[model samples]
Structures are given as C-alpha cells and as structure tokens.
Target chain A: MKIKVLAFGKIADILPQQEWEMDGVVTTGMLRGQLEAKYPDLKGLRYLIAVDKKIANDDSPLEDRSEVALLPPFSGG
Target chain B: MEKQTVNTEEKPSHRRKKVFVEGPISPAFVGDSIAKHSTMMNIGAHSIFLGQVRKDVIEGQEVVAIEYSAYTEMAEEKFHEIREDTFAKYPLTCMHIYHSLGKVDAGEICLFVFTSAIHRREAIDACNEVVERIKQEVPVWGKEIFDNDQYVWKENK
Candidate 1:
C-alpha cells in the first residue's frame, strides 16, 4: 500500500516537500527504514511518527493512503 | 477575534479550535479579546499568559526570529483535548489559546493563553496548565533563525 509522508521542523530540511509515496510498506517500522535509507540526514534527527494525525507511540497499524507526519519536539508556548 | 470565537465553540466536546495565528499576535488583538469578555458578568478573574520570543545568543550568534510550523490536524486535535480536560478539571468560564504560525521576530508576542473563571485561582491554574500541556502535547515546531542567517530547531525546555 502507498503512504503519504509529511515532514516538519528540521526534518523538512531533508525531505523538503512530501506526500512522498513509499511502496509496499506494511508497518511504521518498514516506512521508517525506507525513509532513513532514502534520506540519510533523517538518521541523526530525533523525531516521532504520526499516523493519520495521531502519534504512533506503539506499533500502530497503517492502511493504504495513510497520512504520516514526521514531527520533532514541540516548542510552542 | 470573531474567527477565533467561531472555532472555539465547545459544543459537542470533540469540535476542534483554530489555535494558529499568522505571524506575531498584535497587542490590538489581545486588547480586543479582553474587551469582548467584559460583558461576561460571571467572570471575576482572567489570567493571561503572553509568550514573547527571546533574542538568545547561541554559539556567538544572536537568534533573530523563529518560524513555527505544525501538523495542523493533530495540533488542533490535541488542543481541543487539552482544553476539554482543563474544563473538566477547573471551573473556568472560558479559555483561549493563540500561537503564531509563521515567522515571529525576537521580542514579539508569539503565544497568548487566556483563561476566565469566577475565581482568580482557577483562572490562573487553568491558564498555566493549558500552556504547559500545549507545549508538551502539541506537534508544533519552532526553528530558531539566527541573525547570522543560520537556523536551528528548538526543543521544549
């Protein structure tokens, strides 16, 4: 299944713009691997994954066309 | 101000609020908000928290501004949840949260959190709690742009 990946904060400095399509990714781990491999800069960044607008703290399931966001630490007041 | 009020109607408890303000929040806007609340006779106290962007010298470079971004869908969801939880925990008449979306220069107001209640203690506590929760829970990120034309991502302290 294809997934929609969005990048934010410093992560965007690497992936820039996304709605990136990663093919045949079954889990968040698989998607993470693919992203880390494609953009090596992502390897050093500390961030979290949000599946369909919610943080994937666990091994959350992702379906086709899932909207994923790579979010760094929040600094808002 | 009207736009903000429209988005903050906590009718069903699941409805999301628009918390993002483009660029820095102006003093006029803040003043207007407070003026609008004057007619609410039940509110005895209103605690307001204004977050000003600081000019910090880091690595000998002066930070000029901060550009903020967010996962809007998730941020709104988290904001709504935090507001609801605060409402449940305190006896607040209403609460408002506004944060900058784009570039906010040093010394400018970037965030405004206001809570109104019948008592001063509840209003003060709710404002602090909401601000704390938003900092830790929301997916908004700020990139500090230095005067030397360098940038660094900021983390919650």
Candidate 2:
C-alpha cells in the first residue's frame, strides 16, 4: 500500500521533503520504523502520528491514499 | 434579498470562520471585531484572550520574533472540534478565534479568542477552556527566532 506523508515542525527539518509519498507501509508502526531507519535524526525526536487528520496509535491500520502527518509538540496559544 | 439576509445572519453559527492570518493581528483589527458586535444586544458579556509573542533570552541570545506554521487541514479540524465542544459545554452566544502565520515580532499579538454569552460566567469560562484546548490540541507550531538568527521550536508547557 501507498500513503501520503506530511511532516511538520522540527520533523520537517529532519525529513528532506515536507510532503511526499511512501510505499509498502500498512500501519503507523511500520511507517515509524521505516522513517526512523531512513532518517536517523527522527529516532530521537518526539512527535505524534496523525492519520487522516486524527491522531493514531502505532497499531492503527492504514490504507491507500491515507494522509499521515508527523506533528511536533504544539505551542499555539 | 430576504433569503440572503437570513443566510448572512445565520452563517456565523453554521460556517467555519477563517482562523489563520498571515502575520501579527493588529489592535485595530481587534477593535473592529468588537465594534461589529455592538448590534448583538442579547450579549451581556464578552471574554477575550490575546496571545502575544514574548522575547525570551535563551543561552544568552535574545529572541527577536516567532514564525508560526501549522498542519492547516488538521488544525482547522481541531479548531472546529474545540468550537463545537465549547458551545456544547457553555451557553455562548458567539465565538471567534484567530491565530497568526508567518512572522510575528515580539510584543505582537498572535492569537485572539473572543467568546460572548448572556452572562459573564459562561463567556469567561468558555473563553478560558477554548484557549487551554487550543494550546494543547492544535497542531500549530512556533519557531522562536533569536537575535543572532538562530531558531528553536517552541513546545507547549
């Protein structure tokens, strides 16, 4: 399966592209592992995974065309 | 013409108001917003929250400004949720929220939350709840820029 990945905040700095496509990721857990392996800097960062605009746990299932966002800690007032 | 007037009057409660501005929110704009509410005679109280960018020195470096960004789609959804939840929890007559994008200088306003109700308790409590939820739930991020051009991501405390 393929998914759309969106990166934000400090995570964007670690990931080369802010928005991109990824393949063969079926769950949020898989995506996290692949991302950390590909971008070592991501391993130490604190972030949350939002799938389809809702925060998702690592075991959350994903589908094709799903939009996944890596959100850093929120600071807005 | 009659239908249009009805729609105009009813849209505020139904439509999602635009919540993002390109830069700092000016005081004049805030004043204009308050002025527009004069015709809402039933509103007996209005609670307002303004968030200003503060200059904090870190590692001996003086902060100059903050550039904010967001996952806009998610942020909008979160804002809508907060609005709905607040309305359900309090007897508010109206609510307005705005947050800044791009660069905002120190002492400039970045967030504005206004809540109105028939009584002071509801409006004040609703406003406080909305602001608290915004800080914790919204996906907006602020990049604190230092005077030397260094920057760091701000995290909610």
Off by over 4 Å in 2: B1-12
Among these predictions, the greatest DockQ belongs to 2
- For residues B1-157, could you state the per-residue lDDT of candidate 1 as single tens digits? 3444423242325456678888888888888888888777898999999999999888888899999888888898898899889989999888888988989999999999989999999999999999999899999989899977789989998
Highest TM-score against the true fold, candidate: 2
As a whole number from 0 to 100, the lDDT of residue B105 in candidate 2 is 97
The true-versus-predicted C-alpha distance at residue B144 of model 1, in Å, is 1.0
Best by lDDT: 2
Collision pairs in model 1: none
> Candidate 2, residues B25-120: lDDT per residue as tens digits?
888878877877888889899999999999898888887999999999999989989998888889888888888888999999999998889999
DockQ of 1: 0.83
In model 2 chain B, the worst 10-residue window by lDDT is B1-10
Residue pair clashes in candidate 2: none
Q: Give DockQ for candidates 1 onward, in order.
A: 0.83, 0.93
**Model 2 Cα shift for residue A56 (angstroms):** 0.4
